[model samples]
Target: MSDRALIPLLSAIALTAIIAACLVGSTTMSPGRLLAAMVGAGGAGDAIVLWEIRLPRAIAAFVVGAALGLCGAALQGLLRNPLAEPGVLGVSACASLGATLALFYGAAALSPIAVPVAAISGALAATALLAFAAIHTSSVITLILIGFGLSSFAGALMALLLNLAPNPFTLSDLISWTLGSVANRSFDDILLAAPFMIVGLVFIVLSRRALSALSLGEEAAHGLGVDLPRARGFVILGTGLVTGAAVSIAGAIGFIGIMAPHLVRPLVGYDPARTLAPSAILGGVILVLADIGVRLIPSPAELRLGVVAALIGAPAFVWIAIGRGRTHG
Candidate 1:
């Protein structure tokens, strides 16, 4: 389908997913009641449930998912690698490491803002390292290897922190946070992350044309007057902001960044620039649906959103790897 046609369809699907998410919690709510509650016309109890709990949680899912999707598309286009993702690139891992440090040292307890700020700092640091590595080498394989090293290092750091936890409670909290979820998130979390997400998204959007030029090859992109360094800066900064902010609140949700772009690429005719919006929308849809499924599944305790995402994402990652291997072979 054309981009024009697909936008409406994707928007409709995203809206439907959001509405479904709002209605599928433990206390099932009808659409009319949900709407009335949102508009402040429902019963006090329903109003609280709808406005205070479900609404914020659902919005968080959408926003985080959108950030992941956009970052994934931007990275894929920037690196020209199908396997590039925040988690795979160690960006999310680094962010997790930063948050883990905050939690371990009790900085997070001191202030709600500390964790997110630390996470964003880690993400930006990782992105800067990646960009620096890219500057010295044009090889995709080298960049991927660097990302692998970064991810491994971050993972090791987190594991060390877990081993040194002062108590089992701290260990459990760290583990749960790394497992990722938007459950019980408030508008406060959303408000905290929104500015970073928005700024990062704008940076990515501004580089669309540059991404399109780079898709043709560096020499050609240069010939077409694309400032390669500036483009890289935008992508790196944007990815850091979006991925870091997302990890701060959501705690390392994976694969949406990788999977969302791939899912919508064909729909957008495989144009890198065109893939951004659809990927973001589809990412939001996927997360909202996943969050709803986590709630609906029969369990004494709700499933973590990150676990659900990894369950789905891991298989997809394997499939993509296999497909790429076959194509290359």
Candidate 2:
């Protein structure tokens, strides 16, 4: 098969292996027993560990990773910014701050839906404000400046909430969650995030054709019959919602949005339509593997997935920056 075709197949196999490894590594069970538990043949202890614990984290990693990937692609395509990312642009921070507030004020503690709902609202609000700032600015640099401003504001608010939390445990939990982890995610968390992700996915998928048009530049896209304003709105809405759900569950896992899409874009021969799906798959694979790697590398104490990704991505970013400098120079 060609390189384009090989990627999806490889990604699928890699994801399966990582998932299997996670299941096996989470406890002392052999692969055979893990498979048995997965297939409902094992006993209650197997069921509890495999299903109740490992399964949820695995699924969360996949779903949240997919959302992050899709959002990254959409935001990059919409803004035509290689560095545009939900977390980096600060939308995820806004969502986290909103969720933190809800939890701190006992709104989410009192109602099951409050955290995600509040988070989605906050994400949408931030996007809207950013959009408004972008509209008046007349330049991409201005847009980036506005995005940075919004992100900074949201981050500051999150810090304030951390200071005001009622107890040290609450503060620690919120802080750690903001640092991002898929450990001990529940069915409720899945349900809460699913709708936003699904809806966002639909909009993102719909924008594939528009994204292709967009790659040629907005004026050219409009000249070619793409509805620029409508497409922009759709992309913004999709990114915001997907980002919100991801933050609500996984906290602010940065760079996956920018890193995943950019890495995969060249593999698809720069076809934006093909880029989105493959990026999503690779994104899921990346996060799952990162989570599993963190678990395996340190053994008992469990390293954070975000830290692992950052370590890898930080070097990758440096390499990319150096390459770009050489190319331009």
Candidate 3:
């Protein structure tokens, strides 16, 4: 199918997955019950389950996945590197690290919003750093390396926190933040993320034309009057916002960003600009399905969504890395 057809089809699939998410929880709502709940006519229990629990979780999962996917597509386009992703910028790690600190310090006991607030702050800090670098530095490699340093430092700090954990419970909580989840989310969480997500999305949208131009080659793009530095700033800032927002909501869900664009690019004939929406849709579907699988697992403690994502995404990441390396070499 063409890009137009493919996008709508992916969107339909995403919708189906989200609906499945709403209907396949522990209570297993029937279509009729789901409809009634949508219209606010279901039983009180059903409404609570669907509206407060399932629907919020499903939407949060979609929003997180879409953010990562859009960031991945735009990053890959900007860098002209297939291996690029939001995590490549270290914003996701920094965000998670912030949340880990909150969990470590017991801020979560004070308020549910504390962890998310910390995570988003961390991500914005990364964005500010990257934005400054984009303005001052001419090389993309410098930005990537700086991100690597940030990620490495953040990972080390997280490890230290894990090691210095005062108790098993604290350790487990810290680890869980890394493992990631959207369980027990509510509309309040979504509302909190909306503004940041919108800002991030706008940055990416504004960078799309520059991304398309850069795909031809930096010199050719410059000839076409693409403001490379400005584009880089927008892409980096956008990526930081969405990535932080995603990690805040879902606690460092991994690989969807890289996986989404890679899977969709072939279908879209590898047009960076055309890849964003389809990648986002596929990313949402992937996460929803992963969460569904998490629900279906027979394990006693319920599989963490990040665990499932890593299980699926890590292999794909390696495979894609290999493919890109060989093609480029």
lDDT of 3 by residue, 231-327 (tens): 8788877887788778878887778889999989989878899898889888888898999999988898989998999899989988997897698
Clashing pairs in 1: none
In terms of TM-score, which candidate is strongest? 1
Best by lDDT: 1
lDDT (C-alpha) at residue 170 in model 1? 97
What range of 10 consecutive residues in model 3 has the weakest lDDT sum?
A: 130-139
**Between the candidate structures 1 and 3, which one is better when assessed by lDDT?**
1
Candidate 2 residue 238 C-alpha distance from true site, Å: 0.6
lDDT of 2 by residue, 91-173 (tens): 87888888888888889778888888878877888777766665465466677667677778887888888888889988987
lDDT of 3 at 293: 92
Would you list the rank order by lDDT, best first?
1, 3, 2
Which lDDT value does model 3 have at 130? Answer: 66
Per-residue lDDT over 1-329 for candidate 1, one digit per residue giving the tens place of the 0 to 100 score: 78998879989998888888889888899989988998999999999987788888998999889889889899889887778888778899898888889889999988988888888889999989988987788887788789889989988888898889889999987897688999989999989888888899999999998988888987899999999999999999999999999998899898998899999998987888999999998888889989998999999888999999999998997898789889986
Task: Tell me the number of clashing residue pairs for each predicted model.
Answer: 0, 0, 0
Misplaced by over 4 Å in model 2 are 1-7, 136-139, 299-301, 325-329
Clashes of 2: 0
